[model samples]
Target chain A: MGTELVGGRTVLGTLRSDPPLTLRQTGHGTVHLVSTAAGPLGGDRLELAVDVAPHTTLEIASVASTLVLPGNGESLTVVEARVGAGATLRYAPEPTVLAAGCAHRMVVRLVLEEGASVSWREEIVFGRYGERPGTCHSRFDATIGGVPLLRQEFVVGDPAVDGSPAVYGDARCVGSVLLAGPAFGHPGPGNGGRPGNPRGHASVIAEGCAVLPLAGPGTLVSALAPDAATLRARLTWGLGRS
Target chain B: MDAALLLLADSRLPAGGHGHSGGAEEAVRTGAITGPEDLARFLRGRLTTAGLVAAALAAAACELATAPGAAADQAGTRPDEPAAGAAPESAWRELDAEADARTASPAQRNAARTQGRLLLRSARRIWPSPALDTLAGAVPDGAHHPIALGAVSAAAGCSPHDAALAAAYTSITGPATAAVRLLGLDPVVVHRVLAGLVPDLTSVARTAGARAAWERLPAHAAPALDLLAEQHLRTEVRLFVS
Candidate 1:
């Protein structure tokens, strides 16, 4: 999917879709992902590429939460996005459920131009109801002007690691919202000429949530909760504070 | 194992690592870690996630420090030293930034850099390596702890594998010590827990040292750990700084 600025409004340029990963335009600059089939079942591979042209804005969201189911092998989904100069891209997908006996991997690579900005939000629900969660690996890599801003991967579902106090500590839902670019007015690398301020101050807005300013021009809001609703609420609150 | 590696791994190195719990304090306060069993589980999880990241980074930094032209650049400022080029400086900057990228929580990044700065201060006096000076010049505020450990280890004639081992080992030992102090657990039992993790620790270090590229370092994030770090920062009377 691609977007371009035309006549003072963002318009879709290259809208392509493949089975199980269909794209639907709900409004100008807004696209909703509609999954036609269930189960990114084990062994499934899915990919999505997005391009936001200069001065354009694109917001991509999913209509519902995705459920990962077990199959013959592991499943993979990769999303690569590029935002041009002065462009904005908001990719807010619903929560992902890692069901019992399933294994899944999700990778998102986002690159921004000199003046580009982005808001990327992700939430994960470990297993459904009371069942143990299957393995799910999520990697997000973002860079601006060829300089890395954030590169992280979270691997969950292992009972030993996930249930450890150092990792999950009883939280079942986890999420983060990354807001980057000049729009947020965050201090760039070097923290606006302040030395020794490398650990940008983080504001704890809720019980288990915080909004942290990055060393670069970005802010990350992270939260953990016992339930999906509380997790989303904390993330939303933290985003507002950020 | 080099004696210098053991020295670098010593908890009493005056690196200020004693002030941080590596998220164990927060876990204790939250009732996640009540005894030796919980601490053991937590240490194992941490050894795989944060420990792996630090080990890989230390290995990469050590490799860079021993790179052909790097030694020349570190041989003090000479008129002809410019011929060594900007590679070493740029490489240090990139590695430090990569450390920042991998650390999503501001509190955790701050803690790592704080320990890094202090470690550099002490290592410079003990080892007095030109590489340490080069690293200091590159990242004036401070290099991340793993990077500093790697450079200091190189100055002490240790291999990348040794640096990785020290990095991985400290990731657990520090927290284990903190748990003993905070929870009043039996030191013997905590050491027993650490002993049990020896196999996993070696494997993690081996895996981390095997990675040749800085960009491909392990970035396994533990959301609960990130959350705990942030929360620890907000506690008015916390025992650890992060």
Candidate 2:
């Protein structure tokens, strides 16, 4: 996937679709990920690449929650994105549900150039209703101007560790929103008169959710809840969207 | 392992480590760890995630401190002459920034730096090495705890692997000790839990030490622990600072 700015409007440049994962342009500067196939079943290797050109804005979202089902072996998905200088990328995907007996790995690498900004959100649901989750390893690496911004990986599956208070506690869902760039009060090349609140102070929003301002120009809103609804609600609230 | 490495791992180092519970206090309060078994599970999860990250950082820091020309450069520079220190100073700054990137939570970062500042203070007086002084000059506020530990370990004649071991070991031992204090768990049983974790601890340390590149260090994150660290800070009355 690629985007370019034409006549002060963002336009799609190149979008190559593969099986199971397809991209649809829903509106100007907005794209929705549509899953054409049923399962990213075990042993599947999927990759998605996104590039947003300078001065362009792109918003990518998903149509529905991803269901990871058990299959022959482990499944892997990698999404790599680059936002060029003065560009913006907003990636808000639906929650991924880890079904019982399935093993899935999701890796997202996002690179932002100087003056670029991103609002990336990720959510994970342990399992379907009344079912125990399998294993899911999620890794997110974000870098700005060749420096590390956020590098994190989470593994959820083992009952002992997942249920521990130091991990998931009693929460069946976990989520985080990473807001980085000059738009989020991070010092960059230029703001370009973008409307962004400079108040990036850290604060607790709810019972198990908090907004953490990074040492750099970024903010992370993290939350855990008993269910997907509550998790989304808390994350939304953490982002001040609710 | 060097004997001084044991000193680095000991809880009674006056590095202000006792004031932090590594999220065990929050886990206990949430009833996620109600018994010795639960505590054991929590420690294991932490050892793999946060512990591994810290171990890798410590190992990387130690490797940088002991790299060819680093010692010589540090030896030629005065504590106040950070500009004259050259490569080593920038290297330390980069490692510290990497630590900041790995830590998503402000509260956790604050806790790590607080511990780092105190550890640097004590290490300077005890080991008194040019490398440690260079690190202090590089990061006036503080280096992350793991970075400081690695540099200090080098000054105390410990290898990078030893620094990794110390980091990985302390990550769990501190929480185990806190669990005993917070949940009133049997000290003997907790010790048994720690003893059982030796194999896992060694393996984690080995993996961490094997990686020499600081940019590619382990970045495993425990979401519950991050949330707990933030939530712990908001708690009106809590035993641990983080």
For model 2, residues B1-242, the per-residue Cα lDDT tens digits are: 88888788888888888988998898788777789988888998899889999999898788777762443332232344344333467667778878988998877887898889899999999989888989998887788999999998888889989999999999999989998899888899999999999999999999999854555678988878887887778778888887
What is the C-alpha lDDT profile of model 1 across B107-206, one tens digit per residue? 8888898889998998899988777888998888788999998888888889989999999999999999999999898999899999999999989989
Error of 1 at A210 (Å): 1.6
Error of 1 at A7 (Å): 3.0
lDDT of 2 by residue, A126-235 (tens): 99998999999998988887777889888899786787667777889999999988856534221112222265335555687878776666788888999999999889
* Alpha-carbon deviation at B144 in model 1, angstroms: 1.0
Best by TM-score: 1
> For candidate 1, what is the TM-score?
0.93
Real A-B contacts recovered, model 2: 0.61
lDDT of each: 0.84, 0.84
Top DockQ model: 1
Q: What is the TM-score of chain A alone in each candidate?
A: 0.93, 0.92
Error of 1 at B203 (Å): 1.3
How far out, in Å, is residue B214 in model 1? 2.1
